[model samples]
Target: MTQARITIDRDFTVAEVPRRLFGSFVEHMGRCVYSGIYEPGHPEADARGLRQDVLKLVREMGPTVVRYPGGNFVSGYNWEDGVGPVEDRPVRIDGAWHTIETNAFGLHEFVEWSKEAEVEVMEAINLGTRGVDEARALVEYANHPGGTYWSDLRRKNGAATGTQQDPFGIKLWCLGNELDGPWQIGHKTADEYGRLAQESAKAMKLVDDSIELVAVGSSSRQMPTFGTWEHTVLSHTYEEVDYISMHAYYQEHDGDAASFLAEGVDMDAFIDGVIATIDAVKAAGKHSNQVNISFDEWNVWYQRGLDGEDQPHNVAKAGWREAPRVIEDTYSVTDAVVVGSLLHSLLRHGDRVTIANQAQLVNVIAPIRSEAGGPAWRQASFWPFARMSALAKGQIMQLAVDSGKTPTAKFGDVDAVDATATWDEQTGRLALFLANRSMEEGAEVSVDLRGLSASGVRSAEVLTIPEGGDRNSANVLDAQDTVGLKTLQEVGIEDGVLHVKLPALSWSVLELDVERA
Candidate 1:
């Protein structure tokens, strides 16, 4: 077995753990909306037609913020189509996912669901076909009090009822989604998008100056115009916007599990590269206000095997079908491990990358999966996310690792053992999230805790390939226990050292109480 050592100190702090870092996305695509979160007749549905079981799981997952109404769907969406009376709402074709969209669930419905799930709403507007005028109108409709035309429309739409619905007060908004990608419905050049985003941001802020706006960055690091895109966009929209957006999805290709497991290495590089780009613009413009990254869309998605299409596009294909199943990837043990390590990469960069949403939050590449009339259960990737959301508080600590290298085809040789920790001084909680990327052998990992006040292990849990199980095994449909969180009986805190038995291709969480040191 290979061995690794980790050293963490409270003094070596990265940044305060941003609650929005654990955010999620809810888009109008496929079963993600119709049967995904809103099935009026489901056994577990509430008065609002949202699945109570999914809300329960979402609450358990503890996402602090959720972006609404788009992936590429927002690029072609009209805010007016989803508001007012559900009967009067438009039944439009969502070209993004090639599915029918019955606007039964829109801004008000999502705001109501957000209240039930206890999450902040991150709204996105249509800057693709529409521009500054529509963005301004949306801000007025959602945030303005009575007396205005848009606000009156919202009042007529049922948000004026005295149940704390007057002003939705949604603070964070996305100017557009993936405008740089050619697959988008109304793709624009960097200069075009940057100029549009700037004007829209200005108009929206005039309606509600207290709100924060996110300008579009490159869709992903692999884009042909990655660095140049951000530079051009930020050059135009830097001062008007508070944050720039980043989106990425990782997947294993051509049986390259070894390289896929080391996805965090690539993630770290991508984040650092973006930070460099953002700072370059800031330095050139000499902007006083700081603009950080809002990594709004990210998750492990299998885009290759979906259709004959090489990439995810916003083109119409499935005629007109409502609630069609699209890109519903059943995550496995290995996928869960990669997700945990990706969370580690996000946490380690908490200072700059303030807001992150895990792609689509429901049946579309989410942590919690639910069927139309079936049951809702946690996926294999849900455990680490839930555990970290529940326990990771206060500041993210810098971790020093001395570990062996794992050779990979993609990311060169990455550390075999990757980990990150968050320390909360108020609650006396120190939570450690670890991942073992070794595909062949188990690892013996020890964490040096000499600087800590030293408390016994509170709880240790791991998700690994179960006995007589394959690495690709998943908790799908009715059979829920293929690979889930199981207690790690082989962990202990011995004399300022945390010894954990990490099986190959595993993700583990260790939580313990320690006084501030």
Candidate 2:
């Protein structure tokens, strides 16, 4: 077994854990909308037609913020089409996903669902085909409290009646979604997008100055215009926008599991690169208001195996199918480990990357899976995310690790054991999230808690493939325990030292209370 040591001190903290960091996405594509979150006649559905089973799981997962409407779907979406009465709504073709949009679920419906799920809505506007006027109008209709044109219209539409929280109360808004990609409906050059975003942001804030705006960065770090796109866009909209968006998807390719396991290395680099770009622009422009990263879209999507090299653009060639199954990649145990590592990367950078949403909430590469009219179940990726969301709180503690290095095809030399620590000073609780990246051997981790007046462990859990189980094992509706997190009974804390054995290619969470001297 490989051995490693981790040292954490309460005085050395990165930042307070941003509550918005535990966020999820819900786009109007695939089964994510129709049979996913809303199924009017499902046996488990509530009065609002939202799946009660799914809502229960979502609540258990504890996402603080939820981004609404569109991955690519928002680029050409018309906000007016999805408001007012559902019977009066229009049925149009979603050109981005090549799917027919019934417009049954819109802004009002989303707000209703978000209330049930107990999550704040992060709204995204359509800058792909529409612009400043429409964006500003949306803010007026959703936020303003009566007496005006749009707000009065909202009252007439019955959206403000019988609710303590009237006018939607949405604060975070996205200027556009992936506008730099050529595949977008009204894709534009960096200069063009920057000007449009700036104007739209200015107009929207005029209607409601309390709202925070996010400008599009790059669709992916691999984009040809990655750094340049950020620089140019920030040059124009830096003063108007509060955050820049980031979207990324990772997958194991061609039997290269080793490199794929170290996905955090790539994620760290991507975030650092964007930070450098933002700093460069800030220095050049000498702006006062600070800009942070809103990583609104991220997940482990099996893009390569989906169709072809053009998988993301593989919209329904069979013509407009409503709620058709698309890119529903079944996650494995290995994928869950990589996801845990990715979460570590995000938490490690909590100082700047304030808001992050794990792509889609259900049926579209999400942690929770639901079958239409069938039962809902947890996927392999669900355990790590759920545990991290519930256990991690307060401030992120800085961890220094001394470990053996492993050479990979990519990322060169990476530590065999990667871990992150969280210290909640208010509750006197400390949690450690650890990942063992080795494919063949277990890791013995020695945690130094000397600086802390620590008590006994509250709980310790680990997720991995069982003795007879394959790494590809995943949970189904009936067999929910196939690849789930189980308690680690062998962990011990002796003389301020934590000793635990991490199974190969697994993720673990260890928690305990601390008392200050």
The best candidate in terms of lDDT: 2
What's the TM-score of every candidate structure? 0.97, 0.97
Error in Å for residue 348 of model 1: 0.5
lDDT of each: 0.88, 0.89
Local error of candidate 2 at residue 128 (angstroms) = 0.4
Superposition error at 237 for model 2 (Å): 1.0
Q: How many clashes in candidate 2?
A: 0
Q: For residues 298-379, what per-residue lDDT tens digits would candidate 2 score against the true structure?
A: 8999887557522446755566778778778788899999999999999999999999999888988989888999988888
Error of 1 at 368 (Å): 1.8
Q: Which candidate gets the maximum TM-score versus the true structure? A: 2
> Residue 381's C-alpha lDDT in candidate 1?
87
In candidate 1, what residue range of length 10 has the lowest lDDT sum?
308-317
